[model samples]
Target: MSLGTVSQAGLLLALVAAATLSGCGQQTLDNSQDVAAALATGGGSSSPQATERELPTFDCNALGERASSIEMLICQEPELAKLDQQLAEVYAKAGDKAVNEQPPLLKAEQRGWIKGRNECWKSEDKLQCTRDSYQRRIVELQARYHLVASTGPVFFACDGNPANELVTTFFETEPATMIAERGDRSILMFSVPSGSGAKYQGGDYSFWEHQGEARVTWGYGAEEMLCKPTTQDDK
Candidate 1:
C-alpha cells in the first residue's frame, strides 16, 4: 500500500478508538471509561429516533414533468437508473422495518440526505457523485436495517505494529450496526462502502479495504493508514 507519510499504527488505533466511542452507551461492554466517554456521541442526527425509522423511497417517475436536474440526469442514464431502482428496493424493505418501529428521526435523516444528494448537481462530477451518493446510502441502510447478511467478523493486523489489530462484529440492530474492537477498547462502525471493498465509518474515523490493503483514518487531524492483512494472532 502506498500510504505516503501516514503512520499505519496510529491510524489503526484512531479508527478502533473512534468506533469504540460510538458504541459506548448503546451497549454494555467491559472496556475503559476513557473509551466509554468517547463513544457517548456519534456522527448522527440529534434524534432519539435515529436508531429506528423508515427509510425513504425516491421516485423518478413520481417526479413526472417536474423533476430536478439530478433526478432527470439519473433517469436519462441507464446505469444511474439501475442504481436508483436498487436504492428504492432496499428503501422499501428498510421502510417496512422502520414503520413497525416508528423511528421519526430516521425519516428526518433520509430527507436531509436527499437534499444533500440533490446538491451534488453542482459538483464537477455530477452524475458520478449522484450515483455514488445513492450507492453509499443504500449500503448504509442495508447494513443498518440488517436487510442483508453480514459475512461475520474480519480481523486485520496493522503493518509494522504486531500488537495492533482491528476486529469487526456485525449485529442485527434496529439500524444494522457493528462493533470494532482492538484489545480492551471497541467502537461502533456503520456500513459505508468505499468502491468494491467494505468501508465502515464512525465518529472521527473510518476503515476501508481496497486492493487487499486496509486503509484507515482517525480524523481530520491525522494521516491515513494502509496496512496488510495478517493472522489475527499475529497482533
Candidate 2:
C-alpha cells in the first residue's frame, strides 16, 4: 500500500478523506490478518477475568414495555442527560469488545437480530417503508465494516490486541425483545420498543459521520428512534 503505486485519483480521495479523519487512530487496521491475533476469538474458552457480556435472550413484549418507560424518561431534558452518561459508558466498552469477538459466529447472531426487527416492522402498518430503508443501511454497514450476522440472541466480542485488551469500557444489558445490533466509526446507537414485540416502526441501526445525533425508530404515532444529542447543555 505504498503511495507511489497508487493512481492519482485514489491518492486524492484518500487525502481528502484524511482531513475528516481527525479522530482516527494513529495507525489504521487495513487487514484482519494483521489484526487477527488481536481480533481472534478465544474459541469459547472462558476467561474468569472476562465478565462483561450481551444478553443471551430477549422477549419483544417485555422489551417493548420497557421502551415505553425509557421513551418517556428520555423525553425530558434531565432523562436525556442521564441516558447520555449511561450510554456513553456502555458504548465505550462495547466498541472495543467488538474487535476481538468471535468473528464468524457473532455475525450470525447479528443477522438474526436484524431479520427479526425487519419482520416486526413489515407486519406493523405504522412504519410503512421505514423498515426496508433501515435494512438497506444495515447491509451497507455489514459489508463496509466487515461485520458478520448471527441468529437471535447473538453474542458480540471485540477483535483487538491482547496486550491492550479492552480495559476501560462499560457494559450494560440492553433489555429489548426488539433488539437492533448496530454501530460504526461515526455514530453508535440501537433500539427496541413495546407492545408488538419485535414488530414496530422506525427502529433501525444507524451510523453517520459528521451528522447530527440520529435515531432509527419504528411503530405508529411518532413511533421512531429519538437520538437527540446534548445540544445546549441546559444553558
Candidate 3:
C-alpha cells in the first residue's frame, strides 16, 4: 500500500475511536442525569426513608364541618392534642385492667368524664379549665388504676382519736397527688406550693403535712383536724 493510503486508513481508525468515546460520554451523562432526577424526586428505592411524625390520637382533619368549638380547639392546639393523646393511652391501660369487670366501669367512667370535659365551655377560661380537667383526669386514672407507683395507705389519727382516722396515699403523678379517705369519703388532691412542708388541695379539702403530723380539713368550713401518723398497733 502507498504511504498516503496507509496514513488515510490510520486517520479513519482514529476518527472511529473518537466517535465511540463520544457515544460513551453521552451515555454517562444521561445516566448521571437519571440519578439526579431520582434523588430530586425522591423516587428511587435506595433513597432514605422519610422520618415518621407523630399524630394525635384522634383524626384532627376528620372533625368535619359541624365540629364543636372545644373539639376544634383541641385539634388546633398542639398541647391539648398531645394531652388528648396521653389521656387516651392512659385510659386504654386502665380499660385493659377493667376488662374483666362485670359493668365495664372504666368505659362508663370515661364516657362521663368526656361529658364533664365538654362542660369546660361554661367556664370563663375554657382553655385553662379544659387543660386542668385533662391533667386531673389523667392523674386520677393513673392513681386509681395503680398505673403509677404510690407511697401509702399511711394512717392519720385525727385530733388524737384513732376512731376518727384518715387514710392517705400519695401518687407519683405529674405535679404529684394524694387521695385522702375518711370513712367512705375520698378526696383527690393536687400538690400546691407551700413555704413549709407539703400541701395538697382539691375542691373544699386541704391537707398539710409537716414532719410526721398533718393538719387536714375534710369539708367546706370544716374545722381543721390535727392528725398524727399511726401504725397498725395504734389502730
Candidate 4:
C-alpha cells in the first residue's frame, strides 16, 4: 500500500481515470480457474478480514418490484450478496481516504464503475462476470487507498501497447502471493527471487525482471515483451 514518491498531479489524474474508466479492452475470463488460482496465490485465501463489518446492503427497492435478472440475482444470490456487502464496506473506507478534492472524482468514477458492472448482464456468464468486476474493483480500490498493508505494486510499461501494461499489487492475505492486473483481467502470480531481478507467474501471463527492463507475457500463446519502468504507483 505504499504510495511511494508518486507525483501529486499524476496521482490525482490516475485516480480519476481509474475511477471513471470501464473495461474497453477484451475481457476473456470464461474459466473460473483464473480467479480461483489468482486468489489462492495472491498473498491470501480470500478478502482481507473485516471484523464486525457492517456489510453494505443494496436497495433492491430502487429497482422496484420488477427487476432485471441481474438485479434479482444480486439481491437473491448468496455469493453476489456477500460480494456486494464486501464492496460496500471497502468502498466506504476508500471514500474516507479519498478526501482533499478527491471525493467528487471518486464518486463520479464509482458511478461509471456501476455502469460497467451492469454491463455484465450482457455476458454469457453473468454471475461470474459480475463477481469478477466487483472483486477486481474492490482489490484495486483497497490497494490504491492503502486499506491493507502489503509489498511492491511495481508498474511496468510494455513495449508496444499504450493501454496494455502490468501492475504487481500485493495483498496482506495468506499464502503470500501477488496479483498482477493486466488488461481487463487480473491474475495471481507467485514471486520468484532470481539473481538480481524478480519473476512472477500465473496461469495465462508472467512477469520477470531485476533492475533494467522486464519481460512480460500476456498469455500462453503470447510472446514475451520487454517493458520499461513506468512508475512505482499503481495508478
Candidate 5:
C-alpha cells in the first residue's frame, strides 16, 4: 500500500488497533492493544511503531450512516449488513438497559454491537429470500449513553463471516460489546485495506476477511458540539 505520509501511517495503525481488538468468549487481545497503549499513552506520530501498524482497532459496536464511519469493513465487505443489524439490536438493547437501569452517573466509556435497524439509508441484499439477511444495522457509540447519531456509517463485529463475503451480500449476525473507561475522541481511519496484511513491528494484521463481526470502541467523556449547514458558494 502506498501511504503518502507518516500521519497516514498513524491512521492505519489506529485502524489496525480497531480491527485487531475483537473475539469470542472473553476473547483476549493479541495485536491491537499495543497501539491502544500508544494512543492511550498520548504518543502521537513520533513513534515508528505507529508507522507500520496498518490494522484498525477492532470494536463491533461503532455505527454511523456515512461510509467513512465504519471504514473498510463496509467499504470492502458490505454484504454484512444483516450482521450489522443484529449487532445494532444488541446496542439498542444495551442502550435501553442502560437507560432503564440508569447506571451511576460517573464518567465512563464503552462500545459494542446491538442488533437494530439503521435510521438512515437501510439497504437489503440482492437475494429476496435473504433481504435484510446481511448485517443492516450500524452505530457509533458515544459517551453519556447514546448508540447512534446523525453521523456516518457504523461498524460492527459478529461471531463469524458467512459465505456471502462481498459488499453485495447481507447476513444476520451479532457482535461483541464491552463497556470500558473512555479514551481520546480521535476518530479511527483506514489507510490500507485489510487484505494488505501490512506488518507493524513484526506483527502484520488482517481484518478485511472479517464478516458478520462488528467492532466498536468507547471513550470516557464527551464535549457537546454544534452543527450547522454552510453555504457551498461562500468561504
Candidate 6:
C-alpha cells in the first residue's frame, strides 16, 4: 500500500476532474481492455519481450500528453498497477455472471466506482486511500457476485425473538466479508481489527461476534441487539 512521494497539487486537480466526470455519468468504453493490450504490445507487435513487461489493465499511455495525476501514479507504481490488473480480471468474471441482467448494472456501477477511486487524491494519506479503495472494491465485487468460496446462511435470533432474525453468509474475500440480510434489506460488511472478536462494519450496520453470540446494530443510532446463532452447523 506504500506509494512513493507525489505532488499534492497534481492530485487535487485529478480529484476535481474525477468528480466532474462522475457527475457527468461517463459510460465505460467496451474496447478499453483491447486498447490497453495493444498499447502493452507496442502497437500490436505482441512480441515475447513486450508481453514480459507488466502494465496496468488500462492504457497508461492513453493518458497521452497530459495524464491525470492518479493515472500517472498507477502507471509508475507496480503495486497499484498490479491491483488494477487484479480488479480488471475479477470485474470481468463478475460481468459474465451479471450479463443477463437488464440495463447492465455492473457496467454502470463500475463506472461510478472508477470515479470514486480517482477521488482518493483528496485524502491526506493519498496512497493508503487509493490502496484501500482498490482493496475494498475487489472485496465488494467478489462478495456481491459470489466469485469466491462462501460459508453459511447462518441464522441468528435477535433479542430473544425467533421471528426477528438475521441471516448471514461469509465470503472468503481478502479482508473477509459477510452479507447480513433481514427482511428485504441486506448490508455487506468488511472485517475490522477488534480486540476480542470478529467485527465487521459497512453502511449503517455493525456486527460483532464472539463465541456463538453476536451483537448487532442494524441502523444508525439504533439499539444493539443481542443475538445467538440458531444454526448448529454454524455454531
Predicted structure with the largest TM-score when compared to the true one: 6
Which digits, one per residue and each the tens of the lDDT, describe model 4 over residues 49-162?
A: 322222227676587866667767776566777788888888899889888653367788788988888888899999899887887777667766668888776677778554
Ranking by lDDT: 3, 6, 4, 1, 2, 5
Q: How close is candidate 6 to the true structure, as a TM-score?
A: 0.73
Between 2 and 4, whose TM-score is larger?
4
Q: Report the lDDT tens digits of candidate 1 across residue range 76-144.
A: 666666666677788788888888665555678778988988898899999889977887777678776
Worst 10 residues of 1 by lDDT: 48-57
What TM-score do all the candidates reach, one by one? 0.47, 0.19, 0.72, 0.48, 0.18, 0.73
Task: Score each candidate by Cα lDDT.
Answer: 0.69, 0.35, 0.85, 0.70, 0.33, 0.85
Q: For candidate 5, what is the lDDT?
A: 0.33
Residue 89 of model 4 has an lDDT of: 85
Better structure of 1 and 4 per lDDT: 4
Return the TM-score for candidate 4, rounded to 2 decimals.
Answer: 0.48
Question: Which of 2 and 3 is ahead in TM-score?
Answer: 3
Show model 2 residue runs off by greater than 4 Å. 1-77, 100-198, 202-235
lDDT at 35, model 2? 60
Top model by lDDT, which number? 3
Candidate number with the higher lDDT (1 or 5): 1
Model 2 local distance difference test score: 0.35
Residue 35 miss distance in model 4 (angstroms)? 36
Task: State which candidate, 2 or 6, has the greater TM-score.
Answer: 6
Candidate 2 residue 150 C-alpha distance from true site, Å: 12
Q: The CA-based lDDT of model 6 is what?
A: 0.85
What is the clash tally of candidate 2? Answer: 38
Native-to-model Cα distance after best TM-score fit, residue 109 in candidate 3, in Å: 2.6
Stretches of model 4 off by over 4 angstroms after superposition:
1-56, 101-103, 153-169, 173-213, 216-235
Candidate 3 ranges beyond 4 A from true positions:
1-54, 100-104, 122-125
Per-residue CA lDDT of model 5 for 1-235, tens digit only, reads 5657877999999988777664422254534666578778766564323332322233333534533323334333323443444545555555674764545321142321111222113333323322232322232232223443322222222223222111111111122121211122333222233354221110121123233332222222423111122222422
Model 4 clash count equals: 4
